[model samples]
Target: MAMVFADPEMLDRLAKSLDSKAGAIPQLKSRASALDAGDHVSGLPAIASWLGDTAKDLRRRANILRSPSESPFDSLAAFGLPPGVAGDPDAGKKFQTELKAILEAQKNGTPQQRAQAVKDYFATLSPAQQAALAATDPLLVGNLDGVPVNVRYAANRITIQTEYTKEAAYLATLKPTDGAYKRTQERVDTLRSFLNPRIKSYEDPKTGQDMKIEVSRQFLVFDPHFGSTADAKSSPFPDGRIAEVVGDLENADNVAFRVPGITNRLDNFNGFTNGGYQLAADPNGNERPDSAVVSWLGYDTPELGDSVDPAKAFAGGAALNAFRQGISVNLKPNAGLDIFAHSYGTLVTSKALQAGLTNVDNVTFMGSPGLGPNINSVADFKMPNTKFFAMRAPGDWVSYTQGHGKDPADFKDITRLGTDGASGHSQYYDPSTGSLANMRRIFYGGDAKPLTFTHTSLDDEQIGAAEAREMVGFLHSKVPPEIVVKMGGDLDAAVQAHFAGRTGVKDLLLEVHSVLGKYNMLDRVPPDEMFGKINDLAGNVAYKQTYKAVKDKGAPDFVAAAAGKAAELASEKLLGAVTWPVVKLLEVDRIANDAKQFGEIIDRGTAEIGGHVRELGTELGREGAQIYNDTKELSEGLFKDGGKVVLELGDTVIRPWNAGQNAADIWKIGDDAKDKIFAKVPDIAGGLNDVKNTVVDKGGDIARSAAETGGKALDKGIDIGKGVVKFFGG
Candidate 1:
C-alpha cells in the first residue's frame, strides 16, 4: 500500500534529514587490501573501503554503501548545496517545517503516522525530486543537458544518487547518528533492495526442491536503425548468430513464439539462438526435450517516438501466419505455445487474432509503455482462447514516458498487450525487486521472494496477482477443439454474411458463435460415444414418426394435420437445441455484469436455421403428397407397398442439402439392396428431385445452427470477436 500525507509537523522532521553531510573518505593505505593481486580481484578492496565511509552522504547516497567505482557521481564535481526550494515558497515552508516534525515523529510516531510522514516528504518532492534524481543517475536519465526528466517508479519517486552533501550534513546536525538518521538509513536500504534486480534460488514448500529464478537482464537498444527489407537485402541480426538452443522438434509439449517490436530486423532474432537456448539448457548442460523457443523478428515500423501508422498493415501478423503454417507442417496438435512480445510486438498479437492462426496459449510482453484502450480486458488482446502475461520492473522508464497523452486504448500503450494488463513500463531488472516476482510466478508458479534491503521487503501479492492474471490467462488461450470447430463454423457464416450485405446478421452470428464455442463438455465425454448418442436419438425419432403416422391415420382429417404437426415438431426440436445454449450463456451475465453477451445471439441464429428447416420440410411434404397422388393415378401398383410408395414419393418431392447421392452412397448400405433400389428408381426424376431439395434445406439449417451455437461458446471462452469490424469498422 502507498503512504498518504496529511501531517505537516512530521514532514518538517523528515526535511532535517534531507540535507545531511557525507562522511570522510576511508584511509585505504593504512589497511591491507582484501585482494590477492589478480586483475579481476584487485579492485575489490578499494571499492569495499569506499562503501564503509559513505554513511554521512546525502540521505540517498548514505543509504547506499557506494564503492568509488560504482559511485554514480564524482564526489568533488557532483557535490552541491541544497538549492533553496524552487517552486512555491509557502508550500515549501510548510513542507520544510513538516519535514522536521516528521523526523521527530519517526522517534515517537505511530506506524500509520510514521507512514504518513514518509508520504509527506515524498509528496513534496514528487515531480521535482523525480526530475532531480533522474538528472543524476545515468541509468535513469538518458541525456543530461540542462533540463531534468522525472523517471517514474511504481507510483513513487526514487531517490537519485546526487553529489549534494548539505542535505546529508543538515540531518546529521539535528539528530544523533543512532536516532532518526539510522532508522531512515535502514528504510532507504530497504527501498533499494525492493528495486534491485537479482537471480535467486529458494526451496519450494510443495516440491521440497530448490527452485532457481533469474530476474532477466533487460537490454535496451537505443534506436538501432533497421530499414525495410525491400531496401536492404540483409539486416544486421543483433548480438550474434543465435545458437539452435532447444530445437523446435525437441519440445514435444512446448512451443515458443517470439515477436520483436518496431525497427526490428536481424538483431531482434538473437533470442531464438542465444537467449532462448541458454534458458532451455538444463543445469546439467543438456537440452530439455520438452520445450523450444522461437524468435520472430519479422516486422516493420517507424522509430520509437513516432505514432503507429494506421494506414499500413504491420508485417508481424503476416509473419505469425507464415510461422503458424510452417509450424503446423510438423508439430502435433494442441502443443502449449508461448508467445513473447516486446514493445511494438503487442500490436502483432492483435493482428494474429485478425488472421486465422490458432492454438496459441501464452503471450508475454516486456518493455511496453501501454496497450490501447480498445483492449480494456485481457480477452480483448488475446487470440480467441489464449492466456496472456505482462512483465515490467520499476526501473524501466518507458512504461511511464511513452504515450503520455495518447488514449489508454491506443496501440502505443504496451501494457494492453496482455490478456490481463501489465500496468507499468519498466526495466526488466532494475530495482531487483517488485514486479520481477510476478514475472517469475508467470513462468514458474508460486511467489518469488522480494529482495530485502536493510529494513523492508519490496514485492507483494497484489503485483503478483496482476502478473499472474496476465500470464496464466495467456496459457488458457487455446480454446478446446470442439468449441473451435463450432466457432469456426459460425465465423465462416459471419464472413459469408458480411460479404452478402447481411452485416447485422453477421454481427449477431459472430457474437453468438464466439460464446457457444467455449463450452467444455469434455469432463466426462468420450469421443466414441457421440455416434452412439446420435444413433439412440435417431431411433427415438424413427419410433415417434411411425407411432404418430399410425395414430394420425386413425384420427379425423389425419393426412394434412399429421404432416403439418411433424414439420412444426422438427422446427421446435432444432430451435430448442440452438436456443437453449444462447439463453444459458446470457444468464452468465446476470451472475456477473462482465459476462460475455453472446447467448441471445446464438439463440437468434438457432431460430433462423430452425425456421428454415421447418419451412423446407413442410414444403417438401406438400410436394410429396402431390407426387403420390399423380403417380397413383398413373398406376395403382405404385401405391401397393405403403413403405415403398412413401420412400419413392419423398425422394421425388423433397430436395435436401447434399441429397444428390443415392441412398447406398449416403450411409452404410447392403450392396444387394442398394442395387435393387437404384434399378427400381432408375429414371425416377421427380422422386430424386423432391428428396434433394428437402435434404439440402435441412443440411444448411443444421450447419448454420451448429456454426452459430459453437461460435458463441468459443467467443465466450476466449472473449474475442465481439462486434468484430463493427467496433473499429469505420
Candidate 2:
C-alpha cells in the first residue's frame, strides 16, 4: 500500500541540488543590494538578510540528508524487497529468529562487538521490516545499541506514550488513599512534562519584539520502571532511567553527555534536561544550531546515606560505557563527543574511562569528591587523547573529604578551570557562573584559559588589583563634566597614578580630605570612626569607589570624602590582623595548635557577633535613612543567631587563603569543622580567633572589652558600606 524506493542515490542527488541553490543565495543578495531603488522603495536590505537566513536553513537540511545516519527511505518510503518477502506468512518467525541471534551475540560480546552485531543485523532489514519490528516491540528497538538515532527516538516516543496511557488508565481507578496513587501521580506528571515541547523565548534586541524557538528533544533511552522490585518496596522513591538528547543529534557537529550525581530521579528530569538545553543552544547567536547535549540518568544513584559505597558508581560506569558506545557508533564522522560529569558522576565517569571507554574528545568534572582510589593520574583512564578538566569552587566542601580517592582537580595533568560566581556543591552548572562558561568552551572547542583564576595563586592578587582598577575606571566615568573642567581634568592622572601604585590609598585620602577641608565641606564627611568603620565593612574596592563617585557628583557628602582615608586605615588594621593569623593557621607545622584555637575563637566570635549584627543592622537602617529594607532583613538573617553564617563567611575567606596547602592536617581542619568547634567554619576560624587572642594579649581585660566594642562598630561600618553600595548601584 506504501511506495517503496530501491535507490539511495536519488537522495544524494537531491541534497547536491539543494546545496547548489544555497550557494547561489549570496550572489542573489549582492544583486538585490546593488539595485538603485527609487525613494519609494524600501526594505531591500531586509529582503537580502531574509534570503541569507533561508540559504543557511537550506544548507542545514541538505547536510542532514548527507549524514550517514539519515536515509531518504527513513522519511519518504520503505525499502523495496522482492514480492514474496512482503507477504510471506513465515516473515514474523524469521524476524524473531534473527532478533534472537543478534541478542545472543550482544549478551556475551564486548561493547564494540555488541555494537557491530546490532549494526550488522540492522543492515539486513528493509526499512519496512524495521518499522514493523519497531512497532511490534518499541521498547527493544528504542534501546537497541545499533538502531539509527532517529529511529530509536521514534521508537522511544512510542514506548513513552504507551507507558503514559497505561499509567493514566490505572490511576483513574485509584483513590487518594490507595497505596500506589501518589507514586503513579508523580510518574504521570514526569511523563507529561517530558511529552510537552520545550519552547525558549527571548526578546529580539534589534526588533524589540518577543520571539520563541521550539527546542527539539529526543529520548534515546527511556525506562519508566527501572529499579529492582525489592529496592522499590523497601523505599518510597521513584527510580527511572533516561538519556535525553537536546538539539539535532544526527546532524550536530558536536555532542556532549551530561551525567548527574546524587539524589537524581525521573521526577527531577526537567531540571537536568534544562542543563542540556543550555549546552546545546548556540552560544554565539547563530541561526543554525550545531551542538547536541544529552542528559544521561542511566543508572541507580545512591541516596545521601548510601553514597559512601562505590557499588552504585561501579554499576553506573558499566551502563554509561554502554550508552557512550551506542552514541559513538551513531555520531557523524566529524562530530566530537564530550562528557560533563558532576559530584559522584565524576567517579562514575572515571570508572567508565578506566574500563576502556574511548574516542572521547573532552571530559570535565566539577564538584567531584574523587575519581577513584586507583586513578591517581590521567593515565589511569584509557582515553589517552581526551583533554581532562576539573573544577572545585572556592568554598566547595567536597574537596576536603577525598572520600572516594584523590581529587581529580589535584591530578597532575588535568586542567583546572575557574569557578568564579559558583560556590558550594551544586552550582557548577548554574548559568551565571564562570564554571558553566568554561564547560561551554570545552564543548565548543574554544580556549577558556583567559577566564581561568585559580585559588591561592598570584591570580588572587591579580583579581584584587583588577577590581581596584575597575573601581578607578568607574570613578573616571562618573566624574561630572563641570567638575572635570573646573579641576582641569587632573582626575585621570590621579586615577592612573593610583593604578600604577605610585600614589597609595593614603595619598588619595589626603588629597580628597585637604580639598574638602579647604572648601569647609569637612562637616559633610562622616566622623573619622564612622568613616573608618564603613570602609572596614566594605568587602571590595567597589564600595569605596561608590563613595568617591558620590563625592565627585557633588551629591550629599555622606562620608564620601573619607573613602580613601578610611580604606587605608581599615586595610592596615583589619586586614593585617585578620589575614596574618589565617596565613599562620594554614602552615603545615602550626595547623595543630593555631588551627584548633582558631576554630574555638570563631565559635566564640560568631556567638558574640550574631545577635549584635542583627541589632546593628536595624540601627544602621534608621541612621542611613535610604537603606533598603531587604538589605536590612538580609543583614539580620545573615547571621541568624550565629548558626551557619559564621561557617559560610569563614569558608569564603579561608578557601582562597589556604588553597595551596596540600597537607593532610590542613584538609583535616575542614573535616573537623563538620562536627567540632570549627565545624562549618572553614579556614577563617583560626584567623578570627587569632584576632581575639591578639587583642587579649595586647591589653588584657581592657583590650578584650575594646575588642567587643569594636565588633559592634565593625557591624555598623559594614551596614554603612552596604548602604553606599546600594545608593551608587554598585
What's the TM-score of each model vs. the native? 0.27, 0.49
Superposed model 2: Cα runs more than 4 Å off: 1-96, 173-183, 200-216, 228-238, 284-288, 447-451, 456-730
lDDT of 2: 0.61
| Tens digit per residue, CA lDDT, model 2, 1-730 | 0111122244445545655665665566666567843332345446555655665665554443222232222321222222223234444456656886888857877766777677778789876666655555667777877777766776666677667667667778878765556656766766655554445544577895666654434788888678532123222344778888866787888889999887677766776666776665444333225778889999887655456567789899999998887666677888989999989999999888877688789999887878877888887785677888888876566654565677787777888888878877878777667887787778877554554746443123222333433333333344533443333223434443454345798887666544433322212222332233334444455445556676778766756746655655656577656654443332222223233334445566666555455544554444343324434443444344344535545665768564344334444544544444332233334434554554444335444544865664565445445434433434
Show the lowest summed lDDT stretch of 10 residues, model 1. 235-244
1-730: candidate 1 lDDT, tens digit per residue: 1111122233333333332211121233223334443544456456554443432233343233221122322211122313222222343344345544665767564333443454445455655443344333323222111111112221111222221132244334544422234433332332232223223334556785665553311111111123343111121112111111134342356666656555433333332224444333334333345555554444454333232332122455665665455344235465666766656665565566556556666666665544442554565544556656555433333432332112122233223322122234423322223333333334332225432111111122122223333332232343443443444444444443343344676586656534443443221221223323433344344444544566557855555456646654664566557545544444333223213335555667777777877887787788777666655543443333344535644774575543555353423334444554455454345666877877886788778787867786565544333322212321
Task: State, as a TM-score between 0 and 1, how close model 2 is to the true structure.
Answer: 0.49
Which has the greatest lDDT?
2
Candidate 1 TM-score, true structure as reference: 0.27
Error of 1 at 337 (Å): 0.5
lDDT of each: 0.40, 0.61
Stretches of model 1 off by over 4 angstroms after superposition? 1-245, 248-250, 267-274, 278-287, 305-307, 310-313, 381-384, 401-730
